[model samples]
Target: MDSLRHHPIRFHVTHWSDDPFSRGAYSSLLPGGTPEHRRSLGEVLDGKLVLAGEACNPVAPAMTHGAWNDGLRAARIAIEAGARRVLVIGAGFAGLAAARHLREAGIECVVLEARDRLGGRVHSIALGPVWVDEGAAWLQQFNDNPLAIHARQLGLPLRETDFGQPLAAAADGTLPDIDAAWEALRAGIDRSLPLADGVARYLESRDEAVRRATRFALDANLILEACLPLESLSVDALDEEGVGAGDRFLPQGYSQLVAHLAEGLDIRLNRPATAIDWSGDQVRVADESADFCICTVPIGVLRDIHFNPPLPPAQQNALDHLGMGQLEKVVLQFDERWWPVSPSGYLRWYDTPASFGEWLDLTDAVGTPTVAGLIAADALERVFAGRSDEEIALVACEALQAWADALRRL
Candidate 1:
């Protein structure tokens, strides 16, 4: 603590909730909502209008690769429909991917993006000399991940996350039994109840200290993982089919991949599709009409844009049931590295609800003295409710120094 000097040089925080383009980071399966709702969003509407994004992908709904793959899937469907011209809304990975492939397949395509730049949730910003990814930084599940292949082929500098590395537990080295809560989850609980309610069934009987540790585990693992308020998440929110293999991080920022996918494409920036009229043979977005249109906007943004003849009642109901989650990040850039550097692992600081969930030791990842902290779940907004970005960053510096001081005492 005594050795720690100089405040952070600068900081950058994400405002997913404030962005009109993307209402939230990703989709969160709320209580009483089934996975079918996610599938329903991906369904094609009369073969003229198809949706593409991570939200539309049932396999890996929140993954960047999922959006990329689904965009290609949607584009192929549009191409098969004998469409000569296509309109792709939103410039995210899905929309860009769809537009690029459609153009290459002898189809005229124009991309409309609400944002000023490319890469929706896969945003990367320069922090001093190093570039830091604000969202979707990692190519997790590297063994089977398509993005990993792209990174390797491009010769982009990559860092494999050592998932096997043991996390630094509490200062006392005591950890809670989070397995029991997970066991209860696997034992088949009521799906109608919220995730917090389901987890309470088992942890409610434990002591305060144990319960605190267990709560930390839930906040860090499940709540933050789902990026939703525990009270709103479904019991099966974390349910998975197969375990993803190794995870990888891009040292050159994810924007390079976005740029590569977006090369030589006719992309119109700062354009938001006000309405989609798919009623006629030729689909239309306002006055601009195309043979087919692929709407890759986020589910929340879907509620904002008007659709002529309206969407299917079933799809509307399903989308209404699903929730958009908040996952924000702040990159604290310092003059020099003061935090402990590890070979490869997350530096976790335990707290109630875990406002700053976990941090990536960017010293090794980006060759800069920076640590990116993820603020997510219900506590996401609470921490940044009325504070400016600088205020929030200052608070984070305190949190980091506290953790450092704690370690020094040990």
Candidate 2:
């Protein structure tokens, strides 16, 4: 980890979080990424270079493991073509995976990350007795996932989550029966999944009834997801993309796993790739170095960086059309354990994003009376767009208080 220094020192490291080179960690599509932009980005810029990042993965985007897989996949293509001096831009999972693959294949590679440490959004902060994940935390489906396999092979500990049953409460002095609500919600999701999948296939085929049928299935899935409302998302979008319904919690945190995956690699911390000079045969990176470079920077970073020739009008337009899913998780701590013990978790409706979380019990799992998390998206701009953590917490407390009062009455 080095301070911001262009004045060449013993170890001058600078993170992209602050550096102008890379604006952020991973690329988040901001309602501007158009289909054409994605197509153009995937085109390989005249066949010499390839793009790799979480955004590139359609199924599991924005996850550490997916980015690593993308990097490895890209590297395999590069190596097959006999790339000698390969340069990996970004030191997170993507860069680390690319470096590992290249090194294992006997190819010379160097990873450059615009951060002090490797793990991008997979950050871990010290909580109480153990370091809990402040960022990505979860291992969903250990059966076929590569990360789970690696974790098992390395003998790392795994923790199973208690997602079997969750609590339910209302804001208006009424609490719903937990067992019944969960059963209904679970059944709803099971019935809606196949319908949603069929809708997607229908939409892809351009059926005349696609519009209405897609809406029906999507609306149903939204109820299952316990979103603010079913109408917030577009039917087409819902059919095209499904939510991460099968999520599992990881005790060690995704960042720890990233660190483990990043050991023994040539990562240049804090060096952001400001301007990519891709005008020549050898892709010139960072406005100077001429060599084949792998751009693993997130899409959000691209929104700010200046592409040497300026991204094409089509690409720029596509960037403008693409949108990022709204997803945020907040953890809260309560003074007293007011939540009921039976399948403890709550889902409530709120006017703001901060109020989305009903209640969750972390007493047994995390060993704290913390309320755990409030997961929501889309409503973010309206709820927490400009609010402070204290303000958000106050809103959460108020919501929880309302829920508690309702429970007591019941």
Please tell me which predicted candidate would have the highest TM-score against the true structure: 1
lDDT of 2 by residue, 1-410 (tens): 02211111111111223334333333343322322344455435444466676666554555666677778777887786678877788886777888888888887777877778777666666554444664456665445457777777777666554443344444433332444432333343333334334334545654434333333323223422323233333232332322233445555456667777877777788787777766776767654352466777766676765666676665566556444434444555544465556353333432212345433344556565555444444444455666676555555455555555555666
Measured against the true structure, the TM-scores of the candidates, in listed sequence, are 0.92, 0.71
Off by over 4 Å in 1: 1-6, 164-166, 171-173, 177-192, 207-210, 240-244
lDDT per residue, candidate 1, 1-410, as tens digits? 23435588878888887888888888878776767887888788888998778877767778888888889999999988988999999888899879988988989999988889999888888888999998888886777678788788999998776644524444344555555645544564545556667667756676786667667667766777778877887766767322135777887799999999898999999888989998888998866899889999988788888898799987787787677888888889887888666567467766654667577877877777888887787776678889988888877777677666555666
**Candidate 2, TM-score vs. the true structure?**
0.71
Q: lDDT per prediction?
A: 0.78, 0.53
The residue-level lDDT of candidate 1 at 184 comes to 44
User: Candidate 2 clash total?
Assistant: 23
Alpha-carbon RMSD, candidate 1:
2.6
- Cα-based RMSD of candidate 2: 10.2
What is the number of backbone collisions in each predicted candidate, taken in the order shown? 0, 23
